[model samples]
Target chain A: MIVGERKPLEEIIESLEGAEKVLVAGCGTCVAICMAGGEKEVGMLASELKMAAKLRDMKIEVSEATAQRQCDKEYLDTLKDDVKGKDVVISMACGIGVQYMALNYEPMRVVPAVNTDFLGANLDVGEWAEYCQSCGDCVLADTGGVCPIARCSKSLLNGPCGGSADGKCEIDPETECAWQLIYDRMKALGRLEKLTEIRPPRSWKTSRDGGPRRLVREDQKA
Target chain B: MKSGSNLEKVFEKGEFALTGECGPPRGADLEVVKEKAKHLVGYVDAVNVTDNQTSIVRMSSIGASKVLIDMGLEPVMQMVCRDRNRIAMQSDIFGAYALGIRNMLCLSGDHQIFGNQQDAKNVFDIDSIQLINVVHTMREEGKILGGDDIDGKPEMFIGAAANPFGDPFDFRPIRLAKKVAAGVDFIQTQCIYNMPKFREYMKRVVDMGLHEKCHIMAGITPLKSLPMAKYMAKKVSGIDVPQEILDRMKGVEKKKRAAEGIKLAIEQIQEVKDIEGVDGVHLMAIEWEKKVPEIVEGAGLHPRPQVS
Candidate 1:
C-alpha cells in the first residue's frame, strides 16, 4: 500500500482560501490504500472546509469527487463531469495524479491536498518512508535488492562511501550503509564474488541527463 | 466569531457557568425542543444545540441555536462535519455567528451508517484537526479557508474534543498536542469515569506542557442505570470506566440507579476538581438535564460565583 499523510489542514485551507465552489477530488489507487487521499478522506476534507467557511460567515461551496486511479486518463475522465462549473478542485492524489488532472481539465484549477513524499510501502499501520527514486536505472540484481541509487544518500553504486562508518551512513545516523546491506545480502546468498567485478561508470545520459524521456512499443501500438 | 459570548465565556472569565445541550427533536415537531430550551433558561449559562448529534437527524443546528438564543439562553452551537461539504459548513458557521451562536465544537462527525440516514452519502471533507485549524486560521490570521484575506474575521472561541481513554493511548497526547499547536483554545474531553486513569492521562498532558496552553474541561456523563453503564462501556470507543465502578453500579437496584449514577458523577467531579491541571468539568447529562444542577450543587460547584 502507498503510505502518505494529508497535508496540514491550515495549508490546505490556505491553498483554497477564496472563491466559492470547490471540489475535493480524491484518488482511489495508492493514495486510497494509504488512507491519505481516498473517498473517505475526500468526504472528511469537504466537511471540514464547509464548517470552516461557516465559522467565517462567508459562503463557500464545497463538493467532493473521487477518481478510480488519478494517474490513469480513463479513471481521471470520471472527474470531467464533476469538475464542470466548480470554481477550484483540491486534488488529494499523488503528484502524478495532480498533473494528470490538470492535463485533462485545462480550464479548471487543480491543487494538491497531499505532499507526494516518496515511493515507499507501509511497514506497519500509520508508518511510511522513502524506498525508490525511479531514476530510470536498474542495478538491484548485483546489489542484493538494495538500490545504492536510493539507499545511499549520494546514490553511490560500487562500494560504500567515506561517510560509511561502523556500517552506518554518517550523513544520517538512522540509515545503515547501503553497501553494508549489499555485502551482507550477497554473503548470505554466497554471491560475494559478484562484488569483485567493478562496474563500469554508468552513463548519465539515459538517466535524468536526458530531460523528460518517453518510450513507445511499435508492436503494442498496432 | 464574536468571541463566543455564550455562558462558556463566563467560565473562561472566572465566572460561574451554565451550559446545556439540545437533544434535537426526534421528528420535527419542535415544540418539545422549544420547551426543553425554555426549561434550561433559568439554569444554564449557554445551551449547546447539537448538530445531527450521534448521526441521528433532527432540526438543523442553525434552527435549534436560533431557538435557544431567542429563548434567552446563550447557545453554544455544536457543529459537526458529518453532513455538509466545505461550502455548506462555511455558510452554516457564518450563519451561526451572524445569529449570535458563538461557541462552536469542530468534529469529524458520526458515520452515516450509525444513523437512520444509511443511504446518505458521507462527506468527511475534513476531520476535527483540520476543522479546528480552519477556525483558528480565520480567527487568528484573518484568512478564510480559501486563502483569501477576509474583510473581517470571525471571533470564535475555538474548541476540540479529546479522548484520553481512547485507544492508541501513547498517540492520543501527541495528537492532542497537535490540536493545541493548531490553535485549540479549550478542549472538552470524552466522559471521564476512572479518576485514577484520568489523573494519569492529565499528568502526561501536563508533562507535555499542554495544560498551560489550553483550558481542559473534563466531560462528566451521569449513567442512569447499571445497564446504561454497561452499554456506554461496551458501545463507546473512548470511555472506559473502571471495573470497580461498574461493579458498584451492578450492586445497585434498577430504580436506584439514576440516583446512584448522580452520586457517582458528583464523586467524579469532586475527585477531578482536586487534580492539578484540571480547569473545570462539563456535565453532559445525556438527556438528564434536571440532574445537572443537583450534581453541580452536590459537588459544591456554585454557578453563581462565576455568573455575576
Candidate 2:
C-alpha cells in the first residue's frame, strides 16, 4: 500500500499564512488504512488548525471532508461541494492523490498535508516497511522472492558487499542484510549454485534513472 | 603482463606481493599524499589511494594517484561505485590510465551515513563485481560496458576486495569465486585479526582452486591502542578482531601499546605469509604511514622483490 504520514502541523499551518477559509480534505483508501489521513484525522486536523488560528488571533474558518479515494475523479467529485468557497484545500492523500486533486480542481490552491513515504506493507498496527521500489523490472524469482532493489542499502545485484556482518547491514545493525536473507532462502531451496552465477550490471532504464515514468494501457483506454 | 604494473610483475614472478594504502586528504593537499608516499615508496610494490574512504570527502583517488606517480611511487588507484555512474566511471578510468595509473581497485565504497555527509545521495549504479567486469572488459576486450569499441583501452590490472569475515561465512569463498569469474586479477581482503576464521575461509577458497585464478592479498591493520582495537571490533563493519588479540593489547601498558600493536601486526604478517592461498599482504597503516616501513621491515618483507 502507498504509505504516507501527515506533514508537520507547523508547516501545514504556515502554508495557510493568509488563508481565511480552509478545507481539510482526507482520503479513505491507503492513507486511511495506515491511519494517517482518514475522516477521523481530517476532523482532528481541522480542529487543530481552528485552535491555532484562534490562538494567533487570526480570523480563519476550517472545514473537513473525506473522499473514498482522492485519486479517482468520481470519488473526488463528491468533495466538490465541500471544496467550494474555501481559500485553500489541504489534501491528506498520497502524492498521487494530491496531484490528482490539484489537477481536477484547477485554479484552486490545493496543498498537500501528508508526505508520501513509499510503497510498503503494514507490518503491525503502526509499523510499516518498504517492500518495493517499483523499478519496472523485477528479479524476485532469482532472489527467492526477496527484493534486493528495495531491501539492500546499495541495491546490490551480484551478492552482498563486504559490509554484511552478523546478518545485518553495515549502515545499521537493526537492518537485516538483504543478501543474507537471499542466501539463506536460496540455500534452503538448494539453489545456492544460482548465486555463483555473476549477475550482470543492472540496466536502470526501468528505474527512476529513466526519468518520470508514465504508463499507457491501450486495452483499458476508452 | 596485464598493464605491466609493478604489483602485476611481482605476482607474475611468483614473488609474494606487498601493497600499502593512503587515504587522500580532505582537501587539495598534494603534500599530504606525497608525505604518505615517502613512507611507502620502496616499502610496498604499489600503494592504494582510497576514494573518499568511509565516505568522508577527500581529494579524488585518481588525482592522488597522479601525485604518487610524480613522487616515484606506484599507485593502485581505488574506484568506488558509490560516487559515480557507468559513464563517469568509464571516463575516469580513461583519465586515470592516461595519467599513468596502471592498477585499479574496484569497490563498493563505505556508505555515506558513516561519514560527515549523512544527507548525501549515493550512486551505486554498479556493484564491485560488475565494476571489475567493466574494467576487465575495457582492458581485455578494448570495449566499454556498452559493447562499443574504444579508441584506447585503460589496460588496468584490476583488483577487488574480499571479506572472509563477513556473515554467511560459507558464502565468502563463493563471493571470491564470483569476483574471479568476473575477471578480477587480484583480491585484497578485509583486515584479518581472526586468523582462524580467515584460514577457514581461505581453505574453502583453496578447495575451490580460486587461489590459482588471482593473487590474494591478506589485509593487515595494526591496532594502535585498546580503544582502537575495541572500535574496530565493535564499530567497524566486516572486520573480526578476535578476543585474544584484544586481551593481548589490554595486557600491555598504555605507553607500549603502539609498539605492541606493531609487534602483533608483524606476527600476523608472518602467520599470513604461511597461508597456502595467500599471495601477499596489504598493510593499511591508516593515518600512521610512518610506521609502515617499520612494520614492513619487522615482518621480514623488506627489500621488496624489485620486479622489472
Please name the candidate that would achieve the greatest TM-score relative to the true structure: 2
Candidates, DockQ: 0.02, 0.86
The list of candidate 1 runs beyond 4 A from truth reads: A1-222, B1-4, B15-18, B306-308
- For candidate 2, the docking band is high
lDDT, each prediction: 0.74, 0.93
- The ten-residue window of minimal lDDT in model 1 chain B covers B299-308
Best by lDDT: 2
List, residue by residue over B101-209, the lDDT tens digit for candidate 2.
Answer: 9999999999999998999989999999999999999988999987999999889999999999998898889999999999999999999999998999999999999
- Model 2 ranges with Cα > 4 A deviation: none
What does DockQ come to for candidate 2?
0.86
* Clash count, candidate 2: 0
> Candidate 2, clashing residue pairs?
none
